[model samples]
Target: MPSNPYADLPAERSWRRAVVATPPFALDPTRPGDFRLSRTERIATAGSCFAQHVARVLRESGYTFYVAEPPRLAGSEAEDNFSARYGNIYTTRQLVQLFDRAFGAFTPRLTAWERPDGRFVDPFRPRMEPDGFASPEAVAAARDRHLAQVRTLFETLDTLVFTLGLTEGWRDRHDGAALPLAPGVVGGTWDPAEYGFVNAGVAEMVGDVTRFVDGLRGVNPRARVILTVSPVPLAMTYAERHVLVANAYSKAALRVVADEVAAARPDVFYFPSYEIVTAPTTVGRYFSENLRAVTPAGVAHVMRCFMAHAQEGDRAATAALDIRSEAMRTSQVICDEELLDA
Candidate 1:
């Protein structure tokens, strides 16, 4: 029998001796450059706030990427808060729902606004100017039409990069749909029977992600996946008397999922953004006032390391064909505040 090459190696130094080094902010504990993003590849991002930053960076860097926001409705009072106005993809449930909608597995929901005159309002009209969609039926039909567009968007994506945020989330009891945020905060309402608390474990998360990847592949075989765990800690926790414990649980579960996915699937790659921020060796000067918001400097350093590593791998892959060339690249480092403004 062959002996394990690392069996006699010192456990402490094993990781350091390995070819890939772990970055500071990684929650998944994966080494850097495990997966390389090609310059020609199309990328799409979803998941937490950090995911938005990744999307923005890729876009600014002249990469092909998609950031899908909710559709803008005419005359909506809370238009700014609407999902359509933001590129956030909401909940993990929504991610799966997008795939289902694309493959014709489920129908989209339509909602209508009612006016005092017992008539339907026009959703497309400005709220100050007129009543919204005239009737419930009309509103419902309009919703379905909007959902079709969303379906098309998902179908067009070549690679979906998702950053896992929180393991604890609210879910619907009747159908097991996950809510993006607490119902009252956004447009959705909360109900006892309709909503339940879900703290996903490592297995459940892996299952959710695996199913999502498989479903997407079923429709688009060339579609690839990249997963990252959010470094931001939970603002609050539902666990009994221990918010810290809850945060640990959430991050640990997400890390496990990333590892399992990377081990099981060749197409599924794990990115170490979480480690890039959290590494003890890296300067803590990059955190915001809250200590959780990774600073702009930190993000730039992380992305710089990532881009450099990716470029190296690309060069190595093409070097054998004598097509490698040294090229100069320029980039701007923006702070978190600047990112917010952008």
Candidate 2:
């Protein structure tokens, strides 16, 4: 054997790795600074399930993130109102389309039926509220209106946090546009060509995201982006006989896209929310109701991690300072209902 560097060398000085013991996975403890949320003066959110949770927590913690509130029908409960207003617009594709229409992605012209006089009208339910057109036509007009507002909206945002949820999506065969959901989920019958399966690869997803960010920057030069891969699995899969495999493929693709984009763009960053929830070390206690629902405890843990990071970024500043303080005060007043039963 060689001398082995004089047969003895002292151990290198390193912080002892603290194990974060929790359900779902254990994380080798990280310094708060290692995962700090950058100080974004303003923020916007879009994407799927995990995005909703992020928005909810940020709002509760007094962050000023832009969330579009839909019109509610009278006598509807909070959950019902949210469902009714947002059910049709859950995914990024849908949001992009919505904004495209608002920003005039397509030129809008009055249909033959929508003549000078209001007498002529769409025989079916009018898609546009102003006139009776098919849902498609209505969506087109709304998209134009949405585009008009995009410039103003983009100017106000400093950071846009988007959670990529699914790679497998349905597209209209005739025109080749992404459908918000399966045809039947919201309304309309499925046509084979009218809707076909599309499983986007990492390159395509990265291209789409880059284009979107670039377009937004064209309007607002100061905006930065934070991207995450949603940890939620598919509700259904187009891939034959293996939804789990499909989900794995989809998430892998999204993760690659996120990392690639972050690397390519100085203004872009990737958050590790997906890894925190799905890491194998924690033993999977984060899920609820047969691995679907993310438990309250899981959410709290995630929020704690997020807040700790955010706090480190700017120790003197807090989001929604007054509102968060008020909420804390209010929560203190409300006794734990669960403990009351005990």
Candidate 3:
């Protein structure tokens, strides 16, 4: 036989044979990388709920997990796990819009959403304050303060880890700003004329995410990015097709786009948490009975892989950190998407 590249490849090529013959968690496919991390690096995490696990583990491991807007409310540390408290950023458009709003490049038209009791919430982050603010002025003041912190997060962090969650989202028709949740689902009134559904294709997501990373780098030239696709399926879909079919399409698109962007950018790298949890070898053990929430065991495995590949310094510094405690802290994570089921 000719001595081609395939002749020297590892057993993971024939790796599927073990999956077909053996049990779950047996065929690990995590690819090693040169994406190094030091204990001093200021790491920021965002994206779907799964990204919270990354931040939590980093914080608990004694790593510098950057937090620009620290929650002042008592008992809110666990809930405020991200670089900021922006809840599950599900789409690339939402991320870019966030950066734009932070820098005052974009201002959403639907500023405040009125509640039944006449109180108002920030339309961009309706759930940021669960009880709602006292008035429109209060909402505006709070949003401005939050945006200032988001600006700091973007400009100061050394590394940014973003998990691509969904391609489906709701956006404003006039301004093209992305909403975290649908207008009616959380606070604002639903107006078909004012709102539009968007299932961003590969090209759109790639463009938006690439622009975001490039913009971040422009402001902070030393920043590096790691992109991961959330293995958790969509909570719901607006597409006319069956939910299962829509989920497959959405996940597949995100996975492909993430790969492409990571490949195109020298500083951007892709991680395989999606594969670790969703692979057939795991036999669905990583998911909760609801099949959406990731199990603690699954989270630990993914983080283990990440730490193994990314962390290169002071490994012993975080070795004593308890994964159980980290898991407990993450259980308090607030995913805005779950409100869709409510």
Report every candidate's CA lDDT. Answer: 0.57, 0.54, 0.83
Residue-by-residue lDDT tens digits, candidate 1, 178-233: 54554433223456665677787777777777888887777668888888887777
Off by over 4 Å in 1: 1-33, 67-91, 107-146, 313-342
> Per-residue lDDT tens digits of candidate 2, residues 12-75?
1122333333323335233344333444356666665566555555655655656333323343
**Model 3 Cα lDDT, one tens digit per residue, 1-342:** 659867766555665553565456444455655487877989999998889888888876777989888865755755667678677788999999899989988888877999877778888877778789888999888888999999999999999999999889999999888988898877889999999999989999999999998889888999999999998887888899998999999989999988899888878988889988997777788898999888887887787777767764446644634557655765687788888877
Q: What TM value does model 3 have? A: 0.93
Worst 10 residues of 1 by lDDT: 321-330
Worst 10 residues of 3 by lDDT: 312-321
Is 1 or 2 the stronger prediction by TM-score?
A: 1
The prediction achieving the highest lDDT against the true structure is 3
lDDT of 3 at 218: 86
Candidate 3: residue 168 lDDT (0-100): 90
Instruction: Give TM per candidate.
Output: 0.70, 0.69, 0.93
Candidate 3 wrongly placed segments (more than 4 Å):
1-5, 17-28, 312-323
